[model samples]
Target: MRHLMASAALAALVAGTAAAETPKDQLIVAFNMNNVLTMDPAAITGGEAVQILNNVYDALLQFDDEGRNLEPRLAEAWEIAPDNMSVTFHLRPDMEFASGNPVTAEDVAWSFKRTLTLNLAQASGLKSRGYSAENADEMFVAADPQTFVLNLPEPGDPKMILMYLTQAGIGSILDSKLVMEHDDGGDMGQGWLTNNSAGSGAFSLQQWRSNEYVLMTRNDEFWGEAPAMKRVLMRHLPESQSQRLGLEQGDLDVGLSLAASDLKALEADDDITVKTETSAGFYYLAASAADEKYANPKVREALRYLIDYKGINAAIMPYFGVERQRVVNSKAFGALSDPGYALDVDKAKALLAEAGYPDGFDTSIRVISTQEFLDSATAIQGTLAQAGINAEIITGDGGQIYGAMRAREFELLVGRGGGGQQPHPDSNLRALVYNPDNAQEAGLTNYQGWRTSFFDPELNGLIEEALVEPDQAKQTEMYETIQQMIDEKVIPIQPFSERVVTAAFQDNVQGLMVDPWTTRFEGVTKGE
Candidate 1:
């Protein structure tokens, strides 16, 4: 009924414009903008908010929409020191903010410094690398108007360092003068910039009604070629059916968040194209090591065979995510081939017997109530039952489900695997498996590995060793070894499907980014 209501309203708008075709000057993209909690780059979480910022901000460097290679953006070029302890970037001159102030080295320095000082969602990437408020001044240095220096704490790969900064966290440079002018009681202008933009990107935030829609207008003074669309509208349509209806009725140009069924139906419909991209992150089954039932590594290994990977991908996960068993995202370097393990009930039973659970046991799987997660958990429950493991499912919204997972209070959980914030292997590995401190009092639960209480001192050592290794070839080898180690160790969390972003858009809406991480409307053009 919610979908029907949204669809009916959009249909009425279409009826009002019966003679006009899809507007070429504006693009209406409807998606569930639940992840867009804040527009402030310092505090924004997840890929959805970053994608929105991509339109309004320019990073010093950015992974292309494909997220395969890092390319220069705000900065024209950069050079790394032989010791790999510092990188100096040469910024593109004659650049101006949307407010028409010159983008200087001071703005670049202050922008990054402010993020760390605020210590919000983006502070982890730098803080984890030994950069702190005390050291931030020494770390981020501005050489001149067009020159900037980022000093590393130790020797590391320049490639990975550049890749790390490519994330919206450290990379989204702000206009120092404009933002500071809007500062309310030293709040860093976060409150004001929440609805406004201060960057020099192709578009500027015009208006944003939380959980409703965000409206953006093209910046005529953009340094690069202006986007074809004069205005961009991202509507908050949570229901996939409503998005599909809007697209079919020509009310929406692109539907960013659609269910797998919606994508399948749209593919069969005329004047719509469904595009899927294997993006960062994964949907995985996690067994908490803190639970006695899952504490045994052998039990975790046995449970891996109970999943029907192919069946899930074909019938349920397509256009939602893909079957990928590798711990790291396949798009990252040194990602090993999937160790194909078909569902073997007998093998699972045999392993259970060997682990002294021949009679099997009862467990509950926790999952968010989203359709795809619930569907996957239901399938897993059925398979586990076949192996004599009676599993009950506990479903809730993200906060309720993931909140428990974060508090280290679940025996089993089906949750999304984060990392893929950047294309680097360390980015995924660190988030998924790296946990240096393990004591309950340590409060290191932010990491998935730590949240699961899956701690291995050696694995932690390897992660740190890999980060500082200046040799790319050697570092890649170390990561490959770490990947194998995690797999062989039966690292409590097992990834089943790599996330894939699927969207249905009008056939004439060209260059829509499927990867939510790098999505932007700057290059999107409408055609006949």
Candidate 2:
């Protein structure tokens, strides 16, 4: 039966439907990043790759178009325990995976457990940061095939539950049958489904030719509103100019992360509708707090003052400019009162002097080899020079640079941190700053190693308290206190700028929903 359904779905994909004739229209999106890795949603982590994989996989819970939490693709509804420690979800009985197997509570439980185990083994570096690993044991048991109960160690916060459920790491549900079948001689680590997908989602992957294109077709057995378009072709045009050219030539229906200059030209085009969202992320320089030379708070603060966010925003991202004072939505959790870090040359000089560098110290800034980052690095280099700091800018490919940052291999590095639609201060703090296991040795985001004796313990207590409070006002207050702590400590230099750029065909696309944290590409369709 499962094979029959899979065959039928493949047949439908082969028989492509015309966009003009169908109520739903197929969208061909071009992005700058190449899909070089596996399609298994659980294994991949890059933003662009995950965004593409989202269509092919269904998470247990997902946020809606408005950023309001919604029980969409999988679970029907969920209830939080009175103590706020546990959440029980009622599954949709009729839903089935693309493989024609029922999506039971066991599958959900197994998926969660598998991901948690994987995180412990493969992603220990990230798990230690309090992203998704700590809550594994809290998810107690699946009561039955359709109902599951998550038992928290304590009265866990509701926000933490929501954050964890929606996080990309634990979001993708897996099929136990498929997973077990793919295991090599019962070795769970060698599961075939690790690289392939067999879950319930709007679209199923049909063909993928690395660095070229990946094609997905609508799942006819999809339990929800059947997609109008028959297929979605995700093209990998790694070069920015080629991606822009593809959009201009009508070879692509949408372009992700359109260059600022290219966006200006496309915005003027009557056919294309340009959209910008204030990303829940920020771009900043991480000076390794763990490194002896750069660990000094005074030195780190001096670097913050030397960053001319205003100049960088104007020169690099003129279209959707944002101030350095505001770190995107994710980091904005606790930061209500702005302990402002302005670009003050005199103040920066004084701080450097206090750090025993009467003569401004020389340091190297490592940045991604992309044109945009290079431009920002150049501007920052000049800005730091004005503050009597001599800094050289170094560039490398994205993979190399990302690895370098993770290893904390530089004196100073330009990077972006903070993610999620509605992130909590505790979430950001744990992931970016205080996670000692993942702390960068040189200029990674955790460069300052600014750990208060009370930081982690207080955060854990506050998180638990916030979960049970249920009062929005009190939650806000708790969050504000966390933000105050971050600001006072100066964990990471919070130079901010709007991060995402999206464009669609104005005549064809409608009901488009954009959020700072996540993009809902499912409901979008071509107009009649």
Candidate 3:
């Protein structure tokens, strides 16, 4: 009944808009902008921010739209030292910032320095690699106007470092001169950067009103090919129905955030096309190791079988993720393609009885209030109850739910995250399985393993060994071993599905990359 009212209102809205065709020289997109907190590259978090920043600022290197290989952007080429302790990048000589300032290697060095010095969200990737403000001068060096050298502070993979830089606006190169001129006191221009852009990319931020819209105009001084669209507007349309109506009415050129039902509807429509791309993350059920009931390995094992993976995937997880039991992304190197788990209520019951919970135990599940998350949790709740385990579903916003997980205070939670941005095994393992310090005072919230209070020294050592292993064949073997160890040991996070991002766009829109991390407006165009 409620859905009927929504559909009626949507029809009315579309009728009111008159199905006017959007301007050929402009692209209008709608997506949920709840996560776009700031424009400061150093302080921004989440994929939404990365999608916006990717066009406003240019990174030294970028992953291809399909996230398969590295491609050059600001840096024309690069070389790694034989010692594997440093990497040198050669900047393009013709690059200029939106303000017409010539881009130099010093700007690259300074941008990295500022990110580390400010110690914001973007600093975590570099900080995890042992790059700190105290060592910024030695680690980030500008050998010349076009040569920028990066010295590794730790003995790890330089390739992995490059991959980390390709995520979450962390590697954005700023126009240091323009940024400093707007600096207020010693904030490192962070205050000014929150609302401004000083990049050499194909687009420049014009105005951004939180939860309303983000307006970007093509950068006249862009170093690369000129953008086909003169202007791009990203409207904050959190409701999926609104996006569907807008797309159907030709009010929106693209819809980045739409519900599964809406996407399916659009897929059948002749005027719209829906594309699904593999994203970097996992949808998993996490158990807090600190909880007494879940502390037992047998209990954790029982919980895994109690989940109806097939049912959830078929019914609720469509368009959100594909069934993926392994922590590593299937597209990543050395990843195992097949999933090995299935629902076994009898086995779950026996395991629970063996774990001294023959009658089953009562627990609650923490999940975000979003449709997909809440529905998944509710489905899991039903499966657990079939095994005699009484489960309660507690729903809240992202901050409230994930906050409890980060504080290590939750019993069990349904969440999406294990970090697969880099097409490497360590990227997922580091976030999902590696926990060097289990002590609560250590405050390593960046690692999901630490957040769940699950730590294995042997697993940690194996991961470290694989990362620094020089031989490609040998490194691949070590990674396979690591995945086996996690599977055999039953880690705190049990992945049920690998995430995917789906978007619907007008059929005439061309060169639209759906992956948020690699999306760029420079090549996007509309047909008459």
Candidate 4:
């Protein structure tokens, strides 16, 4: 009965048919929500979770529509200390949560501390910048009822810390009192938060069924601009064909997970608009340096020349990514917008011969069974074959593929990585290049550099130096030097393309943010 009603309402929303529970003012969006494992801010990962949480939870800061600049959210104003050791944020006065509890500085402090105390997925952003549970009290403090102060635990970039906080769900400030009331045996409300919400954003979670759908209702107690949509129904329509059908039949207001072909077809629809934006991360080819064949720098350099970046971007990466050779994304502050490497079978074969592999060795490429990944791997396999390298493609689910990479067991893999969420160079460099410990038991699987066994003390030192550099001009120069160093050293990871996200929405909807990191449904509205 509920499903029938939802379908009827969605159809009526655009068809002007009989009304149901879903009002015309409500929004119906379809997207693949398979990655939304939990509602707990600290435990949630991926852009889908962040997209939902952005409306349900208000973070200290938020990214602008472009996902480049930071704007005020819960924090009205923020300032970094001259010493770059601390950042203070001034909260707006007279704020209240959905329960009418006065939003206080203690709540903000507790929320930040909770992430570290739980040490969940979201805590890594803070942990990478020297924050820990031991120093939680000193690092995250409430100076007053309307002020929150974040003190750096070590020499690091305060700007990066602010950028980390700008990620909606991860850095969300929770209502401590409400969460504590649901705490189960010092679990810090993890179990309860997995199903419930304790936030002060423009919307509140009404219902969520795993891999089914999520329903959010507007929060009347919201202190900021009132939301336009009374309700938002995010249906778990994973299949692109279903989304296309729904959109074509006037049943879906937005289809976020449509295929490139479907999106191209929808571009011809007069009532639909397709939007695309360059998102964080890179789709690259990585080789495990621990393998004897890939251990030599000459082999790594040959691997770089073997990738047909232009061909891959033009063919398989139409709606997925664009050709980008640099590790740092183009939107970042210190990013270099130049294509450094191209396809050259001759160069690759010469380098391979120099590396003592004139006959070319056999290698296995692990890739996810998804369409884009498998296709990209196949293209690379064809190119590698031309250079006399026999490449075998191994396909599996994300867990089977990335888990092998995390265990440092893969020889070669076509994958997407390089955490570029913070819009800073260190965000990508720290994940893709910096490797402090090369020992087998180091167990630093979180760092891709360690996973691929690419360790350079000088590169690590340079990244560290660049992070703490105060002068903007000198810091940018340092980043340029690091990029050159990466090329000269023939880093294991060769970024062929930068990720780009595409979505199709009804033309009637206004103020829609296409990028998941900055997407907020609050300002979205349906036209009459």
lDDT of each: 0.85, 0.63, 0.88, 0.88
Q: What tens digits encode model 2's per-residue C-alpha lDDT throughout 162-233? A: 655664444667667776777776544335644466767777777776676677778777777887667777
Measured over all alpha carbons after superposition, the RMSD of each candidate to the real structure, in angstroms, is 4.4, 5.4, 5.8, 3.1
> What lDDT would candidate 2 get against the real structure?
0.63
lDDT of 4: 0.88
Q: Model 4: which residue pairs collide? A: none
TM-score of 3: 0.91
Residue 297 in candidate 4, Cα distance off native in Å: 2.0
How close to the true structure is residue 131 of candidate 3, measured as C-alpha lDDT? Answer: 87
Worst 10 contiguous positions by lDDT, candidate 1: 12-21
Query: Which 10 consecutive positions of candidate 2 have the poorest summed lDDT?
Result: 446-455
lDDT of predicted model 1: 0.85
Query: Where does candidate 3 stray beyond 4 Å?
Result: 1-19, 356-359
Tell me how far candidate 1 lies from the true structure as C-alpha RMSD in angstroms. 4.4
Model 4 poorest 10 in a row by lDDT: 13-22
